[model samples]
Target: MASYKRHLNKDYTVMPNHHLRNKDLSLKAKGLLSMMLGLPDDWDYSINGLVAISREGRTAVENALKELREAGYVVIRKLYPNQTDSGIIEYEYNIYEFPQDEKVACQDIVYQEAHNQGTCFQTIENHQQLNTYKSNTYNKRNIKEIQFDLTGKEETDKCPDKSTPEIELEIDIYTYNVQIHDEFEELWKLYPNKKGKTNAFKSYERECKKKKNPAKFEEVKKGLIAYCEYIKATNTEIRFVKNGSTWFNQRCWEDDYTIQNGKNNQTNKKAQPEYELL
Candidate 1:
């Protein structure tokens, strides 16, 4: 008996430096060409398959392939089988082959053969056909153009006939929403207790709804400032303060807060002298 060992050779594809450095070709075209070269010689040449494998948009892949074909970096050949006894012709597509040099030598031969046989080569014609098919199938509409007056006059004065009820309504809504958020932000900043900001905002919104008046926000603002002062004068620790949401919910601003001296242990009110009844 004889022992046999199988040996495997590493397979790789080579790309010319000129093709990689070609300034005439787009970046997408160069990338696609390099990827095509790396594929096996017998790999499938379907455009849809290439698009899926490359993870690129179909239109982008198609355009890149067109660019490569136009640059003479790739050559496509069409094959036709011999007519059967029934006089029917069968057409087969051939995969494109990448050129080995900057000056592609095989293009003329392929073009001449295809022209003689009255067969089509995958090139600009295919791209045009694909675009035509898409346009017809989707029936996309052209973008409408807006004509503007070149004069320096304001738009309102120029186009007085164009009523803008819908536009005005949209603007009003946007302005109102912005004003509400601005007011809330001012209140949040003035609050002494910073925790539970999201909940605090929700509580503020709820208060706004209950009051149904924009002026209420101003009142809340004043209360926040007073509360911050009270916290400082009393020497209250931040941890001991109520969360913003709880303070807002309880309407703490209405409650009267007196400043007391913690260091001297003195009450906010002045102490009266203790005198015997005279």
Candidate 2:
């Protein structure tokens, strides 16, 4: 996908490109803002409405909104039941073209009329409805996700960046407590030693960053395969096998390990990986 937007069609509306270029906003946040800009004026701007169509869950949307609001692209206002502000009716989200300073939302004529009448916005009809939305929550496979609209469909919690490669995509789940590369998972499956996977992955990621190249996944994979073979050929016991973390931490992939009558090991800086992953 194009990293930059181009206005090639008349059917589209234009928006500031700063959101795309903003160093502070994440990829998910940028996509969400672009989506909001594409929405029609009469469309539902409720949190639930936003959540329904998103591949991300409520938490992702909430965090993105918080970032946008702080950057001035979004303004959230609490609507009250009456002029006295005794009861909250609902929140009104005002999307802006530019970052706005902290101030009361500028209302349109229709909004003014509704507020002066001390009535809820057209979406929110009464106090009971407001309480219903606020009180309801659902257990989403162990994660407590707040349900703002009973009518909204479930969200998948996937990253919004469709342009990313599959390897990168797997690493960017952002939530649901998953943060390992597909290549590393493969390595884990092939390794003879199976301890401290969490630490191993952390070390794996750190090692990758040192190379700053994910394309070398094959190198790591081949290294693991060779190491596992060395263990089998040497008849190394499980208790004496090197931990996965130790393999990465010591950069053992460079070691020219061998079985000398099923007993000797060697090391060299120029040693190449042996054995294919499959």
Candidate 3:
């Protein structure tokens, strides 16, 4: 069934959709994650708290949380009672729009804990008896971060690289051909060149989030297929093919595609003649 036309003009939160598109997350988990992320940071985040706002029963909500946790979208920081820890003091739930590995997630937790430090973290001294250097808030806050370095050595203070660059093609996502939404991976698979997927997905998300005229996912699919065929039909080498990120950034699909006889165009080998787009 077709969706009712959406008018995305007001009262919207622009958030990343990596988790929404994640194949590992169940539909219920995805919906739950999306809803939780939409809440303000000061939300009373808990199992029952989410159940109060959602139609899902307690069991379903619990299951969704489990899925989110297993998928790395929901990270739980448990503060043990003491050195001989018996119970948790408080549970800190860290939610992410995108899944992250253990290493990055550990660092991410440090960043979060540091933001609310002194209240939650204590300066545990290491064997070297070296003074713990104060860290200014990595996200530009003036507050110092509580250092938890285990090496008895100072860690270099630096902000995490979280910026996803945006390319301003400024083209309407709607093309002449009408279509439905599909996964970004399909476009990745269809694209001949495979480099810069992280940025390629970012560009894909940019087009998908076009204010009122977001991209038709099928247009991306058709465009990728057409582009692939053009490359093959023209005997273009892989080296001559554009990177996935560059292709998306340039809005290459909007360009009129041309193709010629591979044999006849030996002299103008770099140029494409014309291929009728589907």
Candidate 4:
């Protein structure tokens, strides 16, 4: 069996003097060319084939091929007539190679130019082929990759791991059954007549000012009211959280000890004594 050899050609379209100038070829184009030269001619490749090997999509492969063709290094024979599969076109490529003399001459001219610029090089031909090509001819070494398009694939929220545990939320509650009259009387006693009323209005105004974010305040207010209803139904304990930035008392409730003590104090002494005896 004949061993496959990737052929490099002299028909490169790059200006003869610029052939060895690495910047003359784009990284992707250089890579594609190198790959084409190294791979056996018997092996077939397409734009998609380059996309798969380069892990870059069709556009990248196309750009590389375009660059190679423009440089006159690679010739392509399109294998298929334009045909669409579900609205997408398909195509294949057959690349050609050229003589070696022109390849060496191209490399030589580039090396001499560089050598004149104070860049020292013992000899161009002696330089490692791949390294010399990469260092002198190609601008981009690393291939830019894009994710494969999976527009038509079905997806599910299935977890790969079965052992990951689920978590549950802890729900707590609090209740405040305040008597407005009693609180008003207490305020009157503390501030005295009109002064008490004035102070109360000022405090309310200040609180409203503190609750500057009306949206957040409204949200908290609704949540607090729901929380109050929960306490009324379930009688669970809840602590009020105040918005520090806004001086808004979003919600308030006594501690568990205070609640229990208050409940006990609200009960009749005789009833308490009877319950204790029981």
Candidate 5:
């Protein structure tokens, strides 16, 4: 286990309003936008480089980039370097940049309609018309059927009493389980090798019980994020990555992994041994 020091950057990228307003953009495109925005200012914006950083397949990255470009959120240009003396011509990689004033007016129009309707806008083009009609019908029906209940006691009797300690304890346990489930989901997304997720979550719960304190879970989460980046920078194949349950059980977050300039130099370490859970 190694001590991980996180480098904090004071700078932040500003997301354009159009990106959020545009409901037509796919989830993958939205994710890709956020990921790209987090990159260093001087990052090389090649498609292959983006694929490596995002851990998304090349085709997915390409399609997302194309979507962003068409949506006016990004601008990509092909560059050609100088010809070599040996009469060899090489094509430079495509450069990606954000357009400052590239606002998607369609998104604004959709947002205005949503605002007027007093509801969130639907992304589907055909469904929007159906939703508007349904909303209007719902409003009219509610206005026509406004009924008043004079017997307040009936309402009180139907509701359960305030939660006792036992009930509160049960609720707390349920909430804790939900939180653990959500945290595990986030960790699983960062893990390159998605194997034995069910087993991994079970192991995570056991580990959480052993630790007792929920705050300690942050250490594992931070370590997993750092490890993900380290493995990606090192160009480690998905096959070489350990299963989530195995990694969690072994507490690999403590292992020292080094990442530098989107490259890692810690391949000399021995392979992680496979662990069979009882």
Candidate 6:
């Protein structure tokens, strides 16, 4: 709601290889974006300040600012007047916010999809006590009376003439507030050619193969499912039984949720290319 500024610290410096991790921008561009996000709506921060926050040196920060300006995420409105120096040029940036319409539309779809798949309830601060009671009730009794009735007209077709079974899974998920495990990233470094490796969740399979540890793969998958549950709700409880050997992936909401069985290689010959490009 309020504008904020990036702290001037070395930890925030943008690195070259990180650009590959977040395609569509060079390290400098990414640094500028981070700087803008760190600012509040009311404050007009100087270019020097932004550079200090995002880059290790002045030149790197300046270069990143130029790239961000070209990308249209930032604009140089006018020169900031430095009363003491007449020849000095200081550019004041007008940062842009993400398009609200697109973000709202995406969030709407996510909210609806989560509801249709399982149960998603919005949190009400005032009704926290009541909601916790209901959640506990729902968790303890498998009571059919108030359980979500997922039996409205099931959508058999997603696209024109493409019919797939209406799918549902009873899954208990927990999300963690930690960064993705470094082992997952290491797995990608090992099998850079694996399709869908760009997806953080799908990388688990390749990791298991590289380590030759099937048990570790299962552990990671379960941990991922728990992490997902954790992100969806606070003090969340997801209760579901996996009847057989099943796998849950650790993906962001946008990633597809398909399971690979008894396979260690990319199955889809024409799957999207692996790895993100900057």
lDDT of each: 0.50, 0.53, 0.51, 0.32, 0.51, 0.34
Q: Can you write out model 4's per-residue Cα lDDT over 1-278, one digit (the tens) per residue?
A: 87898676865432222333557787777666767555533343433445667677655565665566556554322111233221211111223343234454243222111110011112133323221111111111111111111111221122111111000000000000022223334433432112324434333333432324322234434443443444455455322212222111211211121225335322111221111110
Lowest lDDT 10-residue stretch of candidate 4: 166-175
Residue-level lDDT for 14 in candidate 5: 54
How far residue 65's Cα lies from its native spot in candidate 1, in Å, is: 53
Better of 3 and 6 by lDDT: 3
Q: lDDT at 234 for candidate 6? A: 39
lDDT of 3 by residue, 1-278 (tens): 87788789876677777877888889999899778767754454444466789888655776777677678776545344352122213234556667757753453232232111111112222211111122112212121221222112342222113210000000011111111124777678788888777777767766764535566677767777777777888788988787877777655665544566545232222444332221
Over the stretch 124-219, how does candidate 5's per-residue lDDT look in tens digits?
Answer: 222111111011111122211222111255533432343221122223344455667788888888888787787888778766645233334788
Highest-scoring model, TM-score: 5
Top lDDT model: 2
lDDT, ranked from best to worst: 2, 3, 5, 1, 6, 4
Model 2 lDDT, residue 104, Cα: 33
Clashing pairs in 1: none
Q: What's the candidate order when arranged by decreasing TM-score?
A: 5, 3, 2, 1, 4, 6
User: TM-score for all predictions?
Assistant: 0.33, 0.34, 0.35, 0.24, 0.37, 0.23
Give RMSD (Å) of candidate 3 vs. truth.
Answer: 22.8
Q: What's model 4's overall lDDT? A: 0.32
Off by over 4 Å in 2: 1-7, 83-88, 104-278
Which ranges in model 1 have alpha carbons more than 4 Å from their true place? 1-167, 211-215, 259-278
**Model 4 Cα shift for residue 111 (angstroms):** 36
Residue-by-residue lDDT tens digits, candidate 6, 1-278: 89999677654533234334556677667655655554444342443344456535544555565555455544432222242122212222334433123322222222122111112122222211111100111122231321232222332221123111111111121111012345555434432133343444434433432323332634554544543444343332333221111221322222332434632221232334333422
